[model samples]
Target: MRPDNEVLIVGAGFGGIGAAIEFASLGIDDVAIVEREDDLGGTWHVNHYPGLAVDIASVTYSYSFEPNPFWSRLFAPGPELKRYAEHVAEKYDLTRRMEFGTSVTGARWDDESGLWTVSTADGATRTCRYLVTATGFLSQPSTPDFPGMDTFTGTVLHTAAWDDSVDLTGRRVAVIGTGATAVQLIPEAAEVAAELTVFQRTPIWVVPKIDFPIPRAVQRLFARIPATQRAVRLVNTSLLEMLMVFGVLHFRQARLGNKAGALLARAHLRAQVSDADLRRRLTPHYDLGCKRPTFSNSYFRAYTRPNVTLETDGIGRIEPDAVVTGDGRRIEIDTLVLATGFDLWDTNFPAFEIVGRDQLSLGAWWRESRFQAYQGITMPRYPNLLSLNSPYSYSGLSYFTTIEGQMRHIGRLFGELRRRGASTFEVTGEANDAFLDEVTDHLADSVFYLGNCAGSHSYYFNHQGEAALLRPNATLTTLRAMDTFPLDDYRFH
Candidate 1:
């Protein structure tokens, strides 16, 4: 297959957009972007449910290169975030290279020609010298296969694919699952619905969030002098990075911080709920770092209202118009909401076939061997393909750091590639093995493995009981690796 473009990015999310903009700045303009959705923003455009907002501080969540000085709130909502993403797409002229509604179906690398032949769902084909897959792990919406999900027929809604058309003002609402998404949407659901019932599999640790509106004066100052916003981003990022290092990666140093955070959580719970049993039901049983902690000031307080009910008994089955608990108790409902998150493994790289050397599918390689990559970018036997947001690549706190760090690394790598006039390069098997070994060896000291993930229901560990999702490195350490790591570890030809 002949090469049609220099680079092809498989998503239009933050990572993809960041890649496009960075490549453009590096004078690589022969790029093409393919998105499956009609719009540009990836998850932000799809998830428009009630009370949808970022949990991370807005100051550090945005692009480091293009910080928005006029964020209305410290925790920006879904609409504003979608707008910000669209604004970046327009600002960088990224839409000119975008092919929306075109989902990539398959990609095959031709070792002889040194190009990737990518096919789409629309029966079209294009080839590129490099393929950058930025498809996020959480892009797919997962619907729990209840015994009678097709039987109820009520207005069923997944938080990822929320339907605002159904009026919840006077309807009985029942929400299932109490993960991060459920915590964010539960408070708002209790407000508008006539009655709200939340089904929880397990209690999660929560801390009070200090979200507020950014005053106009501060916005004016940020716009007038961008240095102020940069400083804020830097300070908050440094503090939050500790959550990754001391909190999750190295649990030994997390003793003091965990005690302080737990004290605050206990105080918040005590102050919010009056009933002792209810407080006990709401309180988490595991350590803070066992699972992904959430930040919400109102989740605990929402149950204090008269219209809300918390159900802890496990689910048995679903009837035509109600849910049956394990003890044979039936709870009637007008709507069923599923806050169940996406299948992290199924949608890891989208439903596509990627054939590498020896006609081996990337999916089969992982299923047969293990989930790994060289610094979460390149893998052995897959030449000229970069998988961003793969296992052991997340920044732990701020995704912006992950995005910026990865984009800079990829840009620098290709810069070196073009300068040397190399047709292709692949990570050495020894290098890939050593890198993954280092990550797994460090897991002994991390909270995910050492402290335990039993009943945590976290996506951090795979089915093999291996903690392979998050990187155990500090933020600055990852930045240094991305910036100055030796290219000799890879085979450039």
Candidate 2:
């Protein structure tokens, strides 16, 4: 079969862009990137809420290969990230290969043709020699199923789909969920809304954000000497590595580090919030590293405002004009903002139908058995299919770190395929099982297994209570493994 493209990536986000860059580096230029959204930038393009910004420091949030020396702040805002995405796409000449507003419904691997036939929502089909699903972990937004949500007369909005025309100034707004997204948005909403009510399902670990503007001189220095920026990135990455490796991943061996992190967050809360009762309600009961933490200088202080009320009572139900708590108390509000996060394991694991060898559905197989990806990229039956956002793929604090690691994996895997003069490659079942065992053993020392994570409804843990989201290794270690994983583990055809 003559394939339309050598490679077809199912996302236009950073992950897809990185995969395309890797494929190009391997001298395979026939690539196409399809995005469901009308534009690139993935999350940056889809989310445009008031106070959206990168949770990690700007120095380490981006790709190491294409470092942007002109970040305005240490924690750059959402717009800057969007701009950075645009810059990277243009610089890499990836824009020409992207198909915006193209929603892929499913992909099926043809045994006879040895090509992946991708189906789009628009009834179009494209067959490619290789298919890479770069769909992000948080692509699918989860809306709550409240009893009376259909009867809500007031304007409702999800953080994923923010309507800017509807202003919150002087509006009686009730924001639900207190995750990372809400932490950044609540403070901004509190300043403008007449009465802001935040419904908390679980209290998040909040630490002070050491965010500040980078001076023009520093930017110039970074541009002039790229090595200087690399040094700063290295320093920042190391600090975050300590937090991830010791404070989270190795909780059993390094409990002190985790406790210290918890203490820091508690202290930050105490300093910002004067009310002891409020502080008690705001503090997370679970361990600090159980759930993903956020850096916020104003989240705790937002509850101090007379206009902002922290509602700890579980939501009983919703009415057209007010929110009824489990205690039977009702709070009237004009706007309802659902900061409720994404559906990960369910809707976003594969994000779309993927039928591999012998008509084995990727999502179904994972659900019936267990979610496993050999080195977080390949499965036994999935020949020439690279699931970029698979379980245990994410390494380190920054998403870019994960992307770069996968890029390295792609480079090595594809180079071996070329050397063998092969058109398709699939991971051996033994290799996949071995990798699964290794990661599972490594996670025994992690916060999910060793520390108290009972109350933390973290996305890290799957339905089977396995914390299979993160790679559970030091960032550097994961990168090395990605580059050096045994090529013999895959059977080239």
Off by over 4 Å in 1: 349-351
Worst 10 residues of 2 by lDDT: 143-152
Candidate 2 lDDT at 72 equals 97
Assess candidate 1 and give its TM-score to the true structure. Answer: 0.97
RMSD of 1: 1.4
Clashing pairs in 2: none
lDDT of 1 by residue, 374-426 (tens): 78778889999988868778865888788888887887787788788886888
Error of 2 at 63 (Å): 0.8
Model 1 gets an lDDT of 0.86
Model 2 C-alpha lDDT per residue in residues 294-388, reported as the tens digit of each score: 99999999999999999999898999999999899999998999999999988998899999999999999998999999888889898999999
